[model samples]
Target: MNIIIWNCRGVLKPSFKKRVGDLVQNHNPAILVVMETRVGGDKAREITNLLPFDGAIHTNTIGYAGGLWVLWNTDRVEIALLSKTEQEIHTEVKVRLTNLSWILSAVYASPRNAERQVLWENLMSVADLHNMPWVIAGDFNEPLLSEDKFGGRAVSVNRSLLFKECLDKCNMLDIGFAGPRFTWSNRREVQALIQERIDRFFVNPSWCVMYPNAKITHLTRCHSDHCPVLLEMQPRIQNGRSRPFRF
Candidate 1:
């Protein structure tokens, strides 16, 4: 199944919703995880009700700051909630067609640099129980290497080390991407434009064994500063061959 992970910045804008609808029409993602929705309660329902997905579990935004929403096509996948918090929606997702089940987490790390360590710890706690394959996607808010960024001030080595350390502790590997290198930008002029691969997916070895050909694609930035990213579990065919990866 294909899954989409994006930081929409905010979804209250009709223009933004129109772009999302366009994506829905073209990609037809089985599951969608949106970060930073910035809407809650009746206002959130007023908006997401328009989506094509039949099932959804979303955390309300806090004073226009942060929100996380996970939407799925019930016919394609069965979702059983595991645990939830403002930063994560952890669940067991089973594909109806293949009878394959695994752990999926749509997590949004805190934007504040100082508070992110706690978020990493929370994720590690989840990773500790490693019975099934797991795919974690979201805006991690930290980069693993200097090369993951573009046209910005250099990323601190300390920050990168911290993030890398956490991923190591959890036995996570960065999934490969097929499109643009960066998923977020400042939308400024040439000298001022800053881009970074802040949003992505990380999988454990079990995931590689399950779908060895899986690949991620980065969609163009539409109305939001962040671009939509899709994880193609059943890899797209090219030249009558599936992309190969080493576990």
Candidate 2:
């Protein structure tokens, strides 16, 4: 199974549908987590229904600001909503074929430090709610390491401490990526450009043990400032044989 996480910024743009279609065609993800949609209410429902997914759920936008949508193919996996906030959605996902189940969180953290602290607290509480395998992915809006930023004000270790601590407490590991080092960029002249690897996937030890060959790829940014991240839960098999491993 595969999942795609992206901060599409807004779903009202003319190209939005086509971009989604491209993502579906290229990646064939069983689930798509969209953040910062900047749309809600009746329009949100209409647009979501038209998307190429079997089912979907939307967290209403907070007056043109944050919004989230988790779309999935019911044929591939079954999703049960657990809890949600303007910044996050927690769900239990079960793969239809193997009957494997896990907790999946789609996050769109606030840009403000104080709000993020609340988010951290909420995540920790949710972590304690269950002992199942867990995987979280989304636009965290904060880089966990200094090297995660480029051409911007230096990342502050003090500011990142809470996020790191949250991950440590939750036993979440940053299942590494295979593409560009950075996942988001401020589109601007070179002299004013800023970039950071804020979008990512995190998994608990049980999840890592379940899908040992899980892979993440940071796809090229097209319609949004953030790159779409793809997670493949199993290694690909070619010609009825497992592909050779590489370092």
Candidate 3:
């Protein structure tokens, strides 16, 4: 089934809810992960209920900075929460009609470089917790390669190296995306402009064996600096169900 991960900026704007609904209608994702929601648990619950999903789990906002929520259509997929933190939501998802099951984690790493090191370590720790096929996704706030960014100041080689080291430690490979090469922008002009591919998915070797054709798409965005990311498994899906995804 298709799964979506996005850094919505925040859902407090007047048009945000409708935009979210439109995305849901268009994509029909089995599970939707939203980051940087900037809302508390109560508000998150209210917002997720407006979508087509039947189940919701969220992490509360710290002041007005960070928040995360995972919404899922329970009828098609079953999810059991393994853990939750300010940085991520870890769960095991199983498809009802088949022996298709895997560990799916959604994470929003810290904007601060120092904190991101810890976040990276935490992600590796999660990898250690399970031997199942694992797919971890979201806005990591760091690019793996210098070419993964454009229109920005020179990419930090050290930062990217640290992130790469983290991935190597976990033995995960990035499941590259289609559509836009850059998923985020500074919305500035000329010398101040910046764009980067910071949101993505990384999967373990087991995942490749399970769904060899899995891919992610950098989707269109209407109200945020970051484009929403969609991960579709096995049929090399482009957008929505037209390209079906199995387990």
Candidate number of the best TM-score: 2
**What overall lDDT goes with each candidate model?**
0.84, 0.88, 0.83
Evaluation by lDDT, superior candidate among 1 and 3:
1
lDDT of 2 by residue, 99-144 (tens): 9999999999988888888989999998889999998888999988
Ranking by lDDT: 2, 1, 3
lDDT of 1 by residue, 58-144 (tens): 886667888998989999999988988888889999999999989998988888877778877888888887668988889988766
Candidates 1 and 2 compared: the better one by TM-score is: 2
- Model 3 scores worst on lDDT over the 10 consecutive residues at 238-247
Indicate the residue-level lDDT of 185 in model 1.
88
Model 2 segments more than 4 A misplaced: 237-247
Q: What is every candidate's alpha-carbon RMSD to the true fold? A: 2.2, 3.6, 4.0
What candidate 1 gets wrong by more than 4 Å, as runs, is 239-247
| Lowest lDDT 10-residue stretch of candidate 2 | 238-247
Residue 37 alpha-carbon offset, candidate 2, angstroms: 0.1
Q: Candidate 2 vs. truth: CA RMSD?
A: 3.6
